[model samples]
Every structure is written in structure tokens, then in C-alpha cells.
Target: MIELFGDATGNSIRAAIALEESGLTFEPRKVALARGEHRAAQYLQLNPTGRVPTLVDSDGPGGERLVLTQSNAIMLYIAEKSGTLLPSSAVERARALEWLFFFVTDVIAPNAQAFILSRDSTAAHGDAVRRLKERAFALYEHVDRRLAERPFLAGRVFTLADIAGYTITTASESELRWEALPHVRGWLERVGARPAVERGRRLFRSDA
Candidate 1:
């Protein structure tokens, strides 16, 4: 089985959701970020950045254990390996990749910036932080419009794009009001109805 080292939110939940949706059994190894476990020397060897959600596959492409870092990358790997949650047609596949990129670049990027600025950065960064938060909302509005046309980001199939976007978006539910974005709210509910999605959502949030 694969070993997933992660905490409860952000990128960690994204990868866990993909693993569950793939129907692959993986061992979830909790890394207590509050205790600086992610900064430990032992963990740093696997991930130089000492980030949560590092995946260690005992058997990889050629029998060697694969050490993969990055949330979306891990999600994509799981989707491709399991042959599920990926669009079949070439056009749809291209669209799926496009949305995944949007999630990583537009959605996740601004949200991460806002988070760091709000929690760790000084008040001097307030202007930049506000800008990032605005950008995130704008990108979400774009996604809402897209969802109004199609059931899923890549059309009909539930692809990695949805997994990536949904995880990040919900991570900030306290800040984002889904009432205005009816399409996005509906999509979140629709995806949340999945067994795997709910399991993944609770993996890092057992306390909730």
C-alpha cells in the first residue's frame, strides 16, 4: 500500500480525496504540523520542503518506491494509475488538464497567498493580501459561470480537476459565501454527495 503523509486541510485533503475516488487503499499517516513534525529531519529527506502530503509508493513504475510531492501531482498520479476520474476523449482530457491548471494557478495560488498573509505575514502586506483574496473570488466566479454550462469542469465526468478545485474551495468555506455563487454551491453539494468525497473530507477532519 502507499503511504500518505499529511495533515488535515489544504493540499492534504485534495490528495486524500483523489486517492479515495480512485478506489485505491492507501495508508494515511498523519503528520502533526502543529508540533513541527513536518520540519523534522527524517521527514525532510522525503520532501525537501518538509511539506505535508508526501506520497511514498512502495512499488512504482519499475518496482522502485516512488516519492512524490505536490498535491495536484499526486492526485493526477492516482487518477491515471487507477484509470478512474479521468475523461476518456482527447478533447475532454485536454479540458480537464486546463481546469486543473486553473485550480493550481488561479484558485490555489491566490488562496495560499491570502492564507499566508493573514496568518503569518505582517499587516504591511494587507494590501497585497486583499488583492490576492479578491483574485481568488474572481477566479471562483469564473468557475461558477463555467459550472452553469456543464455539470462538471470537464463536462460530465468527475475528473481530477473537480477534485483539486473542490478541495481547495471548501477549505475556505468560512471565508467564501456560496449563496451568491449558486452554481458553485450546487456543484459542491453534488460532489460532496459522493461516498469517496465525504470519506476524504472527513479523513483530515475527524474532529469535525
Candidate 2:
């Protein structure tokens, strides 16, 4: 079984969704970031960086071992290893990777950093958050257009691209006006309606 270490939020959500999409059985070990569990000696030994969502693959020659860190890396690893939720065509696969990068760099990272850095003061970081939100909206508009043309980001079927993008983009729903981008709004709903996504979400809540 795959062992995932992270709380049910942000990047951890991405890893959970990907694992569900891969149809693999896994266990989630929540490293409560707020409670400083990530900084504890046990977790630091596995992840020196003290980050969440460290995946441990237990099928190693000796025993279980940490396989990967970083949400996107874990997503790609699950996709490639399971040989599912990825495009069969070369062009589609490339498109999937492109969209994955676009979501991580353009949408997730900037806004997340802004929120994390600005968690203490509302006024001090207002301008930074506004700029980040604007950039996020612009990126969402681009995604909306692409999604309008295709059923999913990578062109046709549901893939890791959607898992990555949807997981991150959905985080800012309350802050973002997705209604302005009707196509994106509808796409997000459909993506979230999947049984696997729902199951993943349910699993997370149960764990919490």
C-alpha cells in the first residue's frame, strides 16, 4: 500500500485526489502542520524539509521507504506508476504536463505563498494578495477558455492534469469569482462530481 503523509489541505488534497484516481489503496498519516507535527523528530527524519504529503511506497525490497515529496511530483509518480489517468497519446500527454505546470506555477504557488506570508496581517499584505488574486483570475480565465474548447485540460478525458489543476484552483473558490468564468465553474463542478474525487474527499473528512 502507499502511505501518504500530510493533512487534508492544499497540496495534500492533490496527492489524495491523484491516489484515488490511480485506483490504489493508501493510508493517510496526517502531519499536523499547525500543531508542529511536521517539525517533530520522527517526521523530520523522513522529510528533512519538514513538508507534508511525503509518499512512502511499501513495496520496496527491504520494507517501506519514502518515495517522493512535493505534491506535483507525487501526482506524476502515481500517474506513471499506476499507468492510469494519463493520456494514451503523446500529444495529449505533453498537454497534460503543460497544464500541470501551468496550474502549479501560475495559480497555486503564488496565491498560496501570498496567503501564507500574509496570514498575520490583513492590511500589510493586502496589496500583495490583491496582485496575486488578479494574477490568479487571469490564469483562471485562460484555463476557462481552454476548458471551454475541451472536456478536460489535456484535451479529452480526465487525467492527472485535471486533478492537479482542480485541486489547487478550488482552494481559492471563496476568494475567487469563478462565476465570472462560467466554463471553468461548470468544469470544476463536473470534476468534483467524480466518484473518485468524492471518495477521496470523504476519506479526507473521515481522517480529519
Candidate 3:
């Protein structure tokens, strides 16, 4: 079994949702960031960066455990481990990876950094942050355009590309609104309606 260390609303939930959708059993080890658990000694030893969603894979050879810190790395790990969420063809797989890379580089990271900057009000700004937000929104618009034709990211099936994109993109809405992006919004509703995503959403809901 794998143990995932993360908070409730973070990408750990995304990993859990992916694992559930992958039909793999894993232990959910909650690390309460609000209580400063992620900065604690033990977790620091596990992840020097003190990040959440550290996946401790216990089934590796010689009893050696693998600790994956980044959420994208964890998603890719679980995706490859299950071998079902990714497309079968080489070209399709390459396209899936292409979208995955685009989401991380073009969409999630820039928007998140700018969102943090705008929220914090301390970060220096110039054409950089504006360009960051612009590029992020532009990539989102591109995603909306692609989703207008296909229900999923890679193609017809709900692959790991959608899983990766859905988690970060939806969360980015806290700073970047998707309502105006009708095509992306439509895709979000379609993917968000999945059973696993619903379960994951309930995990963050106060009413749940």
C-alpha cells in the first residue's frame, strides 16, 4: 500500500481521486498544514521542500520506499502504476504528456504564482506578472477551445491528462475564474460529474 501525506483541500485529494479512479487501494495520511504539520521534523525529513502530497510507496524492491513530492510527479506515478488512465497508442500517450506539460508549465504554475502575488501584494510586478496571467488565461482559453471539440483532454476517453488538468485548473479558479470560459466550464461540469470527482469534492465541502 501507498501512504499519501497531504491536507484535505490540496492536491493530495487530487491524488486520492486519481487513485480511486484507478481502482488502486492506498492509505490516506492527512498532514494538517493549518497546524504546521508539513513543516514538522518528520515530514521535512521526507520532503526537504516541506510540500504536501508526498507519496510514500512501500511496495518497491528491497523494501525501499519512494517519496514523490510534486503533485504532478505523484499523479504520473499513480497513472503509470495503474497503466489504465493513459492512452494506449504511442502518439496518444505523447499527446497526453504534451497536455500534462502544458497544464503544469503554461496554466497552473503561472496562474498560481500570479494569484499568490496579487493576493499577497508584496511581490514585484511588471510585464512579467501581467504576461504570466495573460499566458495562463490564454492557455486556459486554448483548453476551452480543445474541450469544445472533445469531452476529455487527450481524446475521447478520460485519461490522466484530464485528471491532472482538472485538479489544478479547478483549484486555480480561486484566483482565475472559469465561468467566462464557457467551453472549459462545460468540460469541467462533465468531468466534475464523475463519481470519483464528486467524492473528492465532498471531501472539501463543509456540508459534507
Candidate 4:
């Protein structure tokens, strides 16, 4: 069985979404951040970065157990193992990876900044916070335009890129202005309506 160590957050949500889409049987092990469980020595040994969302797969990599950290890596690993959520064609696969990395490196960066600023705020950080929000919206506008051409991020098919972007943006919804990004808003609606996505969103939820 696959064992996932994580809390309720965008990264964990995305990884859970991938697993749900793959129809894999896995156990959700919450690494509580509130009580600082992620920073504990034992957990840090599994993930040196001391981050939530570590995936341990029993039947992985030549029949050996595998330990994976990083949400994107987890998504890709699950997709490869399950033969799902990735483009079949090489061109499409490259495109999918491009957008996935874009979501990781560009879109989520500003959102992360906004989250940090909100969590540790000073009157001095007001302008910086606004700038981060604006940057995130700008990237979303670009995403919206890209969606105007294709139903999903890479192309007509729904892939891991969609899950990666959708989860993060949905988690950070309050900080973004969604009205101006009509295409993105509609795309999100399509993604959110999926039963697998719904199940993944509920995984590790505080109420669940």
C-alpha cells in the first residue's frame, strides 16, 4: 500500500488528487503542522526539508519501496506508476511538464509569498503583500489566456498539470481576484466538479 504523510494544504491536496485519480489504495497519515510534528527529528529523517506530503510506496522502482518528497514529484511518480494523468504523446508530455513546472516555479511562488506575508505580517509588509497578490493575479491572467485555447493546461486532456495548478489556486482562492479570470474560473469549475477531485480535496481535511 502507498503511505502518504501530509497535512491539509495545497501540496498535500494535489498529491491526494493524483492518487485518487489513479484509483490507488493508500493511507493518509497527517503530519500535523500546528503542533510541529513535521519538524520532528523522525519526520525530518524521511523528509529532510521537513515538509508535509511525503509519499512512501511499497511497490515502487523495480519492486523496491520508494520514498518521495515534493508535491510535483509525488504527482509524477504516482502518474507513472498508475499509467494515468500524464500525456501519452511525447510533445504533449513535454508541454504538460512545462506547465507543471510553471505552476511550481512561477504561479505558486507569489502565492507562497502572499501566504507568508499574511502569516507573519507587519505594517511595513502591506505594499509587499499587495505586490505579491498582483503578481499572482497576473500569472492567473496568463493561465486564463492559455485556457482560452485549450480546455486543460497542456491540451484537450486533463493531466497532472491541471491538478497541480488547480489545487494551489483553489487553496489560495481568497487572496486572488477570480472574476477577472473568467477562463480560469470556468476551468476550475470543470476540474472541481470531478468526483476524484472532490474526494482528494476532502482528504486530510480538518473535518475529515
lDDT of 2 by residue, 142-164 (tens): 88889888889999889888987
lDDT of 4 by residue, 53-87 (tens): 99998888888989999898999999988999988
Model 4 regions more than 4 Å off: 121-123
What are the models' TM-scores?
0.94, 0.91, 0.85, 0.92
lDDT of 3 by residue, 1-208 (tens): 7887777764677677777787767777778787898899999999998877788888843678787888878888888888767888887788888888887777777867776676765656766778887777767767877888887888877877787688876776665666668888888788888997777555533466
Tell me each candidate's RMSD, in Å, in order: 1.6, 2.3, 2.7, 1.8
Instruction: Decide which is better by TM-score, 1 or 2.
Output: 1
On lDDT, the leading prediction is 4
Model 1 lDDT tens row, 18-60: 9999988899988889889999999999999989889999987
Question: How many clashing residue pairs appear in each of the predictions shown?
Answer: 0, 0, 0, 0
**After superposition, which runs of candidate 2 have C-alpha atoms over 4 Å from their true positions?**
60-64, 206-208
Give the local distance difference test score of model 2. 0.82
Q: List the residue pairs that clash in candidate 3.
A: none
Candidate 4's TM-score:
0.92
The 10 consecutive residues of candidate 1 with the worst lDDT sum are 117-126
Q: After superposition, how far is residue 180 of candidate 3 from its true place, in Å?
A: 6.1
Query: What pairs collide in candidate 2?
Result: none
Query: What does the lDDT read for residue 100 in candidate 3?
Result: 81
The 10-residue segment with the lowest total lDDT in model 2 = 199-208
